[model samples]
Target chain A: MPEHAILREVGLRDGIQMAARFLPTERKREWALRLKEAGLREIELTSFVPAKVVPQFADADALAAALPELSGVTASALVPNLKGAERALAAGFTHVNYVLSISEAHSRSNVRRSTDEAIAEFERIVALKRTQDGRGLVLGVGLATSFGCTLQGHVDPDRVFEVAAKVAEGGADELIVADTVGYGNPAQVKTLLPTILAIAGERRVVCHFHDTRGLGLANVAAALDAGVRAFDSSLAGLGGCPFAPGATGNINTEDAAFMLDSMGFATGIDIPALLALRRDVEGWLGDERYSGAIARAGLPKTYATAPRTAAAPALAS
Target chain B: MPEHAILREVGLRDGIQMAARFLPTERKREWALRLKEAGLREIELTSFVPAKVVPQFADADALAAALPELSGVTASALVPNLKGAERALAAGFTHVNYVLSISEAHSRSNVRRSTDEAIAEFERIVALKRTQDGRGLVLGVGLATSFGCTLQGHVDPDRVFEVAAKVAEGGADELIVADTVGYGNPAQVKTLLPTILAIAGERRVVCHFHDTRGLGLANVAAALDAGVRAFDSSLAGLGGCPFAPGATGNINTEDAAFMLDSMGFATGIDIPALLALRRDVEGWLGDERYSGAIARAGLPKTYATAPRTAAAPALAS
Candidate 1:
């Protein structure tokens, strides 16, 4: 991992999943092309949840097929169960993201599965990764509602650490701590991040924050202070948790990139281009409420222009 | 002076000044009453600009008259020039905030005076404070566009320091470094804050950030780490500088207060109450854009309640 930060754009999967209107597969592909051209290295292409649950991601396979022929960008998809994992694997995606709700109530209500059942499925997915070529496939486990749960208030940090240890033991290549409902504050982020990093180690830790309660960036700062590097963000601050009512949106990718770039940290993404892509997204969504500061304010007057990095050839799986 | 932070609300003045519609005086008074009830102790009520320039504050006199009953709340007003200062003084406000643009270009464009002339007027304002009833009236001399000016990029830190030193030498009680056009980042904030504080000393250093480029809260955290305790925020993240096109809103007060309260730094403001008041403002503004996360997300499930502090009795003049 270079010192540069990685921002995985979750708008395609997490953003449109909650929209009232479903975008056509072509539009999703267009967004993917725009994001790739903007130098976003990783894009969560879509989720494999059943069409009945979220119609917005109903064209997941179509989108996965239409992914632009961009080299160096890793296209990933979200899987909630063994079936979703199978769909994602069949779609030729190199990376699969699995989410397990740490809050037992949330787990049951969201995926209709007990914690043990979810773990069993996760173990199966890890085993499946071994049978495949294994070189190209990356398996990431996200511990959702790690900070606090809406249905069950005050998620114990001890439980989160335990789950992280289990995920690490189960052979997840990456582990992300998610404040699914945006109940995380900087202090809580500081308290929980170190323990999770200790269990999962540094290379595996990724922090995902929602701006539901306005602590998204603050939590990011706290996690950075705690030594975690990779982050998950959505373009235009799209996406709200279906299970978490009033949970507004994910941390905006362009805004987060701008913040990181301005802090003297290299993000390897073009801030101006990322903002331009936001305009494309807004045009696609039409009447949706898109949130982010960089999209509205443009780049600051004193923005230090980032030097473009040579594009690495697209990885051949 | 306490380990806690103080977020002085500038919404009524800074927020509404750039608004397209003028709020009724009665509605403005109601906002003040509700903000006071929400435990906001310091509020910049209105700017004493000419009615022709900013008709939104035409009722500054009536607003000031209504503020005396708020007891422990310190009602302050912004004075653009000597005439505005006279109006504020005559309105019975003991605390008046004066602003001087540091960038000579910004100073000329904003107040139609050169930087040298603005400093001279600041000296006169300090002298005018002495001629008053000797009630120890507080005067805050704000260095607008201290970080970077829109018209002139790359504001020199030395000039910022010079202005701070001059303001303090002119006998102003407080000094604030303002990012008037939302052009500041954490690195710049961390670097320049100490230099300004070294010149202005500890308690006098205040930071005002605009979230125009999405680094507002991050900049605030950087300032806090640099030992700054006083901040300026607007309720609902209102206000934008019209002269600087593409300028976004200020840092939202309720959101900032929530972050501070959650960090175990006491801000002495009720987070939920402030959010509730945001609803009223949204209704009053109707079609206007209001930015804040706390109001939209509702309160977090595990929100730690603020420790209560009984309001001190109104101090005698």
Candidate 2:
């Protein structure tokens, strides 16, 4: 396993998508800027879906256009199909995540397409990324419900491997295995992560987890032990599984960072800054429920970054 | 790692100790009985503390005497010193957890004794457990703040090992490493658990963690990976560090059972029964803050406990 891990803040994209009220374009831009300021090197800023269906992300183009100003940060956007990919490319987004529900039932309900159709769409998105001029866009194929599905119950691991093998053969830059409804357990992660990594190769896989069953961080630990170096988390734990009844939000970004950093994995995140942003986001979305423990408990006193060493005095007292 | 793990439900003792409203002695006994109904073989029923400081457990004697009626259940109580231990013996309790804060500052604040003094008391208690006639009692020395301390900040691991060695040599039946203030991370557990276990022996070490920072279950995962088989958890994620500001509560018992059972570890727990008890506890402790995601999300659809195999049919449809 790598000594470092990358935690991609996906609150703006996944979190806002499931929210009850829409945050304005200006607030979304503010959130993006604050995320960058909080030392997030990579962030999924928005998704290019139908503005009518996901009105909250109607400002995806604007957010994508504003990414150039934040030169050091890698801005990512979720694209559902070839049309979404084109818009992402037009807006100059260098990273696009094309998500597909591995379960056929979830695929039809979520995207109005079958699993094969979604895979075909992913191939087209990858093709679009290749054809773009002077653009270094990276296309990642995300396997949603890769662990299990709420609608279909237990998804066969063989089917997940089949989809993963196809995505790998399709020439995507990255492969994402997501427990969309948080049906994964640590044992499953311990067993399946190695297989996923074996097919995707090193540095090609990202693990996305939800706190629906409170096993999000445990699954993260399992993936870490399995040598995964990148993960997806949301600030303030903002998003929940729309299909999984009474599910909580995504893995909390600050909590994940705290766990990783404390475990000696260098994540390059300023946790206090993320906590500050979490506070701001909490204020902005005032009645909406947000979940994360670190925000409530604060960091441990033994937290390494909190200026533990005292300054040397010129003369003894 | 052991194929079977024991999750000792400590909510009645630790959780109710911190609550604003006091559960009557009858409710406490009812909670204990329900814990057994939920398939928890071991439970910390109450604490033998002064009623002036902790009125919630004022009926410890009554609970202890009543525990004999709950067949197949190993009832335990928290005893602070020799006096409490004597009371526990008089009440005919067979298991006692003698807690001592490993951090000097925490030890002074919690029990008004220094670390060495507390260790000396533990030695006395062990001697008492050994000297008693016809009392087949088991004594566990719980080293609270073995991970980190809210008052003293970073606790040295060397101190923890020293305490473990002393308790092991003092003839205690078990050694408990407690993250009293929830400052522990997985790396610490990975490094410290083996050392503690080596000193205490396999199945002789118990892990006590708080979800104050949300790593409670993650820490449990770490401990499980380190070959430790016993854990301490609460009913509705109740109980917080009285000394640690903003700390949430203990690891939820239902959450722990779900994770362990799903991971193929036989905890001998009926998760649905625990959830039902959790609901009852929630109703009793109305308006109090409790945490646990499984209660909200319900069990996974792929959960196997409910008659997974289909009965043979005469014909197919």
Candidate 3:
């Protein structure tokens, strides 16, 4: 178990945003509270994007308002521009995530802005964070399509590093390298993570991977070996990138936690508890596909020997 | 791209053994020829066990004799004992695979033999092969449940190494480490592969993984990083161990080829051609469940830039 690895639950924001039917605000709040109680320290609660463009997240502010004020638990929102950032701030979120696509074509199609203009907006969001009443709203920037793009293939590593460095210099508290199209392999991750880490430094680098090509966990192992400690995952492997065709889910949170916890990494998260949460999410979605293994096969018997409390009786039963 | 990877297609032997209905002998022969044409060097063509136990492979002798004699391809069969090995040799198979489960519980349930008895039988099979014809006959001893066993829960690494060493000393040409219950993680792989490789220094070590827990490719990457060059996979992700409950599907052959090819490794096999052959297998097993991503999503666009011919036409189209 490494001392620094962190797993951020993105099912609320990234997962629900891609669902066909909108989850009620009460259900969303219930999930957030249960997830935090399951030992997740940080969660991407919702996106602050416009209501008209993504109606699924129309109740982001209401959900944000209902979040339990747990000490040491950080609730964050995704913001595409300065307007989204302002809304997130107004909703009282202490953490804001701004995503900018590194591929010009994908950026233009996804956010309707050129790469440079998106970076400019990121700078504006960073500047706005400084003037707010110092509740210390941390700003994080994600470089989407940092691996390869659907529209533009073979995104340059230099471009990814450059964007990462620029965002860090512009006052982003952290920079996440994302495989938006799920086009990355372990070799690609090995090639790209060092450069991004070198530019963003050790503490600022977070790795986000997709399971589109079935290389999600392999990519995570590669990044972990390369010294990445923070990861973004969707519960039950929910969510698909609307812009990236066939990009159906992020890495499964329980699967990732199981991998880390079994390897002696302290995730501080309960594996079976997270798996139980998956069952609840599945009931809500009915037949919609959700990806994960811990939900299918209960945690291995050896899990009890690890440094964690006994799994809940209800979950084990 | 390493120079020594051996991708053994197990679709015919392990994949179809559990199928409810038997595929026509001609269809199996067609699959053999197509796989050979696609440049798969070694294939587990069928099992030579009693027809009463597995009726699906009742035509093993006929199917083996019908295979096209290609220059680089080596046809192999799974032999449970000396009788099965004799049958395989009589049918002109140049290679024979002997199964020896490392876990005592699994070995008993799977073959009704103790681990020591299985190893003794392996030695007898090697002796029998040597007495008849030695040149073209390659003997590979597969150590199933090397990582962990479903019934036993934890397989001791020392026991795995000792059995591998004893098998190698007894006359096996190659050794394969199998995660019989899909209980292996990258960390466990990292810890075990080196020890196995060190003990069986002269013999080739092939890794056999199942996607039961969705860590198949991750295990491959870990083994590859640890210098393992050979792997075992089934087309369309077919096959499940009857003795190892909850074990479903070997690592998908097409998906493994795609991952290796995408990472700059030359499998020598054609990716798209394999996908087409996968469809043929799927058609044969009318109601069977088949899995793999490359067949569903096609190859990533970067595949076109490789020094390979165009892929075969899509299976569904």
Candidate 4:
């Protein structure tokens, strides 16, 4: 088992993109800085998508330029296509995440491309990264709808691994398997994550689950049992599934961090600080549905006065 | 691994007791019959508390009488003391559940008894059941705050198992471990449930978790992995923690059943009927903070036409 787990903050990117209101660039930067202060080492700063499509991310370049203020935090951005990758690279982001749907039907509906076309785009993105003159840019591939899809349900594990193999072969720095529509359960996670990990190898695999059906943390538990140590979560659980409106959003970062810390996984996260940010997000995104339990009930008294480290260290193994 | 899992619906007793308005007797009876139609074999009908104290269950006798209408469902009632036990048995309920808090503080505050006194009450309840000439009633012993307590903080696992042993020795028909305040995590469930099952044996141990901190289904997964096949849940995720206002309530029956069924655990539930009932509850408890994600998102299309059986028998082993 790994000594420390990595939680990549995706609120600024994935979360704000789905919001009903436009979050100012300054608030986005503030959210990032607070995340850094809360001990988030990796932060998905923003997405380099067309401003007309996702106006919330129009400040993507501005957020990327402000990353220098968040010292010690490794900043990353989402790139939807070759054009987005160009923008991300121009913004000087060292880490770029490119997503492709594992289900062919979802791929066509979501990214407006077939699975093969997406894979070919990934190859082009990798080639673009390789040709960057003096920049050491790394590209991460996220397999969306890896569990099941809203457009085409029951995505095959073999299909997910097939895309995973292509991502690995395409010289990607990270391989993330996402239950984009929250259609996954723990059984699928335990059964499929290990195979995905085998292809991605150590320190390269990530799990992203939405809480659309209230199994986000359960899926996270299964992935952890399958030896996954990295996950993507949104602050205040900001991003509700587009497919399942009025349902829960992405897995809440504070809640997931608290669970991991309670279970003796060293998350290096300041849960109290994250909880404080949850309150701020609630204020920032007024009337936007914010879901998570720890923010309401508070932490167990056992965690009080304890060091900000994994509690029950012996249990981690 | 068991061929089928049992989900005891506690919506009537536990869920309605916490609601803002009193649910009428007919509504309670309709809820039970609906639960039976949804394939629940066991339902906690109502508590045998004083009508003046909890007016919601003032219809305990009326509900018990209506249980005959639910042909295939086992009707159970909550009995807090020897007085409640007498009432339950007099009402001809075959299954009676008596709760004793494992946390001394919670026991003193909630039930107005010390832990030792609660155990003594359990002994008395068992004695009462044994003395029933030909009633053949079964007594279920529930250890509330078995994981942790809001007032007492960390309830020791050793202390919980000690009470489990006492319940087992007292000749109770069932042993239920409940996280009353939802302070438990997956690691705690995985660690404690096996010890609980060791004392109670198969088909005798039950896990009751609240989604207070959004770890309800995660804890369910851990308990399932630990070989627990019986769980207690409420419809539409009704019932908040009396101790923690605004906290999540009991684990949602539909969500837990869906996860277990998707994971190849034979839950034998009619999910669509449950989902429909959830909408009714949402309307029934107007502005009462109803929850559970599956009711909004609906089940995956993969499970759309599949029979209400375990999807994979091999993985369960």
Clashing pairs in 1: A71-A314, A72-A314
- Tens digit of lDDT per residue, candidate 3, span B116-164? 9999899899889788664557888899999888778788888999999
**lDDT value, residue A274 of candidate 4:** 90
Most accurate candidate by lDDT: 2
Task: State the displacement of the C-alpha of residue B18, model 2, in Å, after optimal TM-score superposition.
Answer: 1.3
Task: Compute the lDDT for candidate 2.
Answer: 0.85
Residues A71-133, model 3: lDDT tens digits: 567788999899999988888888899999999999999989999999999989877988974
Name the lDDT of candidate 1: 0.82
On residues B1-317, what C-alpha lDDT tens digit does candidate 1 reach at each position? 23678888999988889788889989999998988888888889999999999999899998887867777888899999888888999898888999999899899999999999999998888778888856667899899998898888788989998888988877888887899998888778889998888888644777999888777887888888888988999999988897666666789998898777666676778776887788889889776668887877777767756443532221111
Q: What share of the true interface contacts does candidate 1 keep?
A: 0.73
lDDT of 2 by residue, B218-282 (tens): 89999999988889999889997779878878899989988988887777788888888878888
Worst 10 residues of 3 chain A by lDDT: A308-317
Error (Å) of candidate 4 at residue B60 is 0.7
Tens-digit per-residue lDDT, B166-263, candidate 4 = 88887788888999988889988988988899988633888899888889999999999998888899998888767766677899999998888888
- What C-alpha lDDT, on a 0 to 100 scale, does residue A277 get in candidate 4? 84
Top-down lDDT ranking: 2, 4, 1, 3
Deviating ranges (above 4 Å) for candidate 3: A1-4, A305-317, B1-4, B244-246, B305-317
Candidate 3: Cα lDDT at B152: 82
Which of 1 and 3 is the better model by DockQ?
1
